[model samples]
Target: MTLSRRQLLQAASGLALTIGIMGLPALAQAAETVDIDELMKPSPLGDKVLGSEDAPVTIVEYASMTCGHCAHFDEVTFPELKSRYIETGKVRYIFREYPLNQPAYAMSMLARCMPADKYFDGVEIMFEQLRSGALSGTFLPALTKLSKQIGFTQESFEECLTNQKLLDALEAEKTRATNEFGVKATPTFFINGEKHSGALSIEEMGKIIDEKM
Candidate 1:
């Protein structure tokens, strides 16, 4: 992956995490805006919410649909976490788009096309397509199929994709990541305000979640 300036900064932050240290808490306490400019960007889709609004544990994953590691995590890891934590009201798993390529962008757009209630399910379906290598030029076609399964029409799909407001919202998400969140890669995770880069194993994630619990 081509590293951007923001990514380099995140690498430094990750190192701090490795050492069991972070400045975010102190910065928040001081009422200083976190160096992460990404948080300020307004999302057109609002926040991709899962679990309850008041859930104690919030797991936010910034993932690209074209990322194989992300697909793996979605397919293998996320389900278990959802079952054990999110389903039981112990956690809320929120997925935010982090498109790294054109395909990923399309996939993100497709996921957003679903009704708010089905948004995350749409995300899972999109990632499944990506994992199957069917998310290529077949994005719209695949979305059409999934949409049909969920009782959406082709017209609705087209309308959703062509929605300028949604496009602007997604663009805003990308800009926010670059400017505020210091996001530089796909499959980055922020668990309870602590950020993690790269796709970590479920066990590794569980260790952190266990501690938080």
Candidate 2:
């Protein structure tokens, strides 16, 4: 069964309680406006970039692996975005982790544990697993199976999830995004330093990319 948004959030919240990660809170107040320059600053977390660094339009996406909207974008919009803009060198697309739960965090860690060149590949595999219903049952087992497919032995997979340094870096990245950039949801996009939230269609994205160009 497809998890509703509420269910997903609840699941994430429960996971957060167990793992000591901060659960997403409601937007109780207007988000403080952040400096565009600061928002555009390159993060030390090492970007998963898909186009030339010098591309005219830069799209930074803050996404959670367990976010259905993010999965939808990965399955739908990203291919077109990649072909028409990223592959053609009109845009530089960067993906940053903003995991919403322990499972998402663990998946993100697995992705980061791979060689930098393989990071996006790892992300794609995880997204595919989510799409295929493989991520819904016995989370660790599902993740372990996926990890093995990506050349991770059980020992390495366990080590990757427990890597404190990597976890700290990811937490720092998420904190920066939340406090400095006002990111509150998955699939948040900053196109040419303009912040937009939620899953955007290919046409909508095209319009934004065109405007930036």
Candidate 3:
């Protein structure tokens, strides 16, 4: 079913309570009031991309690093799709953050704190760390190893995690997500702005991607 961005947003408002309880610092840019059309616009915070921006299909995914379901999708489904569809220019795939834990949120922040070219690279390494089930271990320590590969020193990683501006932007995105997109779970997807709430198999996602192609 198709949903106007406003309608989809209204469906998601209730999920914001948990985020609120974390008491994140208030940001001047928070989407305190939703502007349905504006909120639907793609975020500028991620590595801005242009891949057949007018491509007939657009896929948006909301994921958290600590989530096993998200890790599964990254490991099994995304690579094939990246090779077949993304690299081939048939669709525009947007990876958006929706972290469920403080550590996940910190990882997401570090990923975005770098130059655009390194953003996804950091994310990939961090995901690999999670795949190893290291998040249950000390997050900062595991993240330190991932950081070194990308030239992120302990100081840089800590700074990125504590950056109020970065946190604010992420919170804004999360707020926009919950109050506007009905995203209640990790690995949630939006195919052309229509919502899919949970993880699906690589085969299942491939079938959908094939249909879109």
Q: Evaluated with lDDT, which candidate comes out highest?
A: 2
Q: Whose TM-score is greatest here?
A: 2
What digit string (tens of lDDT, one per residue) describes model 2 on residues 1-213? 222334433443344222212323122232233476787776667778789978999888998887877878888899999999999999999899997876887788889999888888889988887777777756766677888999898898878776767777777888899888888778788888777777788887898799879
Better of 1 and 3 by TM-score: 3
Q: Kindly report which residue pairs in candidate 3 clash with one another.
A: 9-180
Local accuracy of candidate 1 as per-residue lDDT tens digits, 102-155:
445555766776678888777777667656755344344554565576556778
TM-score of each: 0.73, 0.83, 0.76
**Candidate 3 lDDT for residue 7:** 33
Q: Please identify model 1 stretches exceeding 4 Å from their true place.
A: 1-42, 137-152
Please give the lDDT score at residue 55 for candidate 2: 91
Order by lDDT, highest first:
2, 3, 1
Which should have the higher TM-score, number 1 or number 2? 2
Tell me the deviation in Å of residue 130 in model 1.
1.5
Which regions of candidate 3 fall more than 4 Å away from where they truly are?
A: 1-40, 44-50
The clash count of every prediction, one per candidate, is 6, 0, 1
Range of the 10 consecutive residues with the lowest summed lDDT in candidate 2: 17-26
What is the TM-score of candidate 2? 0.83
Model 3, span 1-213: residue lDDT tens? 222323322332222212112212112221222343543487647534435676666777888766777776778878877777777787778888886756666677778888887677777787776677554444455566676777877788667666766766776787778768866568776766656655566666666667766
